[model samples]
Target: MIEKAKDLYAQLIHAQELVDNSTRRKVLIDSMRELEASGVNCQSCTGCCCTFISNSMQTDGVQTLELYIYLHDKEMWNDSLISRLNEVIKNNRLDYEISTGQGSSFRRTYTCPFYNSGPKGCSISPESKPFGCLAFNALGKGVSAGENCTSNIEVLKQREDIFENNEQRANVYLKSILSLDWDKLPMPVALLRLHESIGKIL
Candidate 1:
């Protein structure tokens, strides 16, 4: 399933080199560059995605890739993991961690599977380059709902116009992935049984 999904994913991507507005893309790119230079500590905080499950759609570019791979690797998705998945489905949550007040739309590892922790550094660094890594520019108050802001990622303050197009494109890309076999989409965590489910449903 993984290989097939990868191939299909590649094919769909190659089929259309959707040209993003060059000016908007450049602005987003510049924001990314500026954000990197600002030196915010994403590695240290790790944020909600690391522990809390993301209730949001799989649109977050590289995040979806990481999530899909994390769900499949049977080595990680054990019986306990399956049970967790069921609970998430039953509860209609992305996932939650009371230990740290993390909540998700569904129950799952909101933390990226590729995440590697070591004294030296995280296995995946922003510098490594990934498309979906969100550097969301927001209107105001960019911290935990109630937490005091240490400092705002000024990029979040950048022109909202920049993100409007990019976010749309990213979403379109992810949805294309989800559309391949909607009849029997992968259920629960690994999203592995999708084909089987589709087969049975048909």
Candidate 2:
């Protein structure tokens, strides 16, 4: 699975090199909308998935970082949020490495910094969420995947596949554009790296 992921990452990067920034952003936005339209409503779930951190289960770091960059470019990234994210990374000790059989992994448990309990959901716009978050139902099909979810299993699966495909491509694009490796880092750590890189360039 790790080798396959790397191969897909490479393909994604190669494909993005042919596209301009505007086109790439459009693709991301359009893909996000399509995923959102799949009827996987969170309702009052209050970020159930975001509440936990697991070594065995986690979101895609590369895709999350790409969303961060997109928001940063749009001037949506604020100092308060950046500071909060950095704090979360620090508190969780996200910088350390854990070794999986396949490779190094980062294992820690903490509420996702992007989760906003006041809103009972994510602080970021739905369109800007990582593909892993977007595809949760399709990929995991947990308790939330019951009748409460308006999306059918087939639809959810299709959307998940699409999101994953886009994410692989986006990760490749981001790796090439940002000159970063997108293998196995915790989400917060990846975000911190991205934040630092953006700070330097700015």
Candidate 3:
């Protein structure tokens, strides 16, 4: 599974390098619209997708930072939230590493910080949500809901392609701007790093 994730990452990187910025943006916009139209309602579900289950999608540092910035812009940042984020990272840090062909991977399982239990959904705008969150459909392959979901499989597949393509473009944009290898990082760790970065700049 780790190797498969790494290969997908590599492929995205390559695709992003080959594609132009304008074309990437257009694809992202069109795909996002289609994904929204698919309407696989999570309202009735238990928000299982927000929880870091055995095979939940991983987030990268760039997406984490973007989410943090979005919340900060909305005046959501406070000392209590920072402390909670720190505690989350400390409690969930993985002791062992999973080896991917590119390098050793460090990931952990934890409920997303942006997830709210009452509504049991994301606090941020859907547009600001991480690529992993946007790409994932409980109705898609490898999910428990696959059997029960009524969403058309064809539409779901198209959504997956668009999500994957946009995610690659996003990664490429991050790489060009940050000039760093944007390996997928555990959500807690990435959020913690984003908090620290904001502290430095502020």
TM-score of each: 0.40, 0.58, 0.58
> Candidate 3's error at 8, in angstroms?
28
Whichever of 1 and 2 has more TM-score, that candidate is: 2
Ranking by TM-score: 3, 2, 1
- The Cα local distance difference test for each model comes to 0.39, 0.53, 0.53
- How far does residue 104 in candidate 2 sit from its true spot (Å)? 4.0
Per-residue lDDT tens digits for candidate 2, residues 13-39, read 576443323343344445445644764
Q: In candidate 2, where is summed lDDT lowest over 10 consecutive residues?
A: 138-147
Report the Cα lDDT for residue 35, model 3. 44
RMSD of each: 8.8, 8.1, 8.9
Error at 88, model 1, angstroms: 3.7
Model 3 lDDT tens row, 31-139: 5456446753454555555665532445664456555556666777677777766776666653234666676564557767777754436787765565445544545
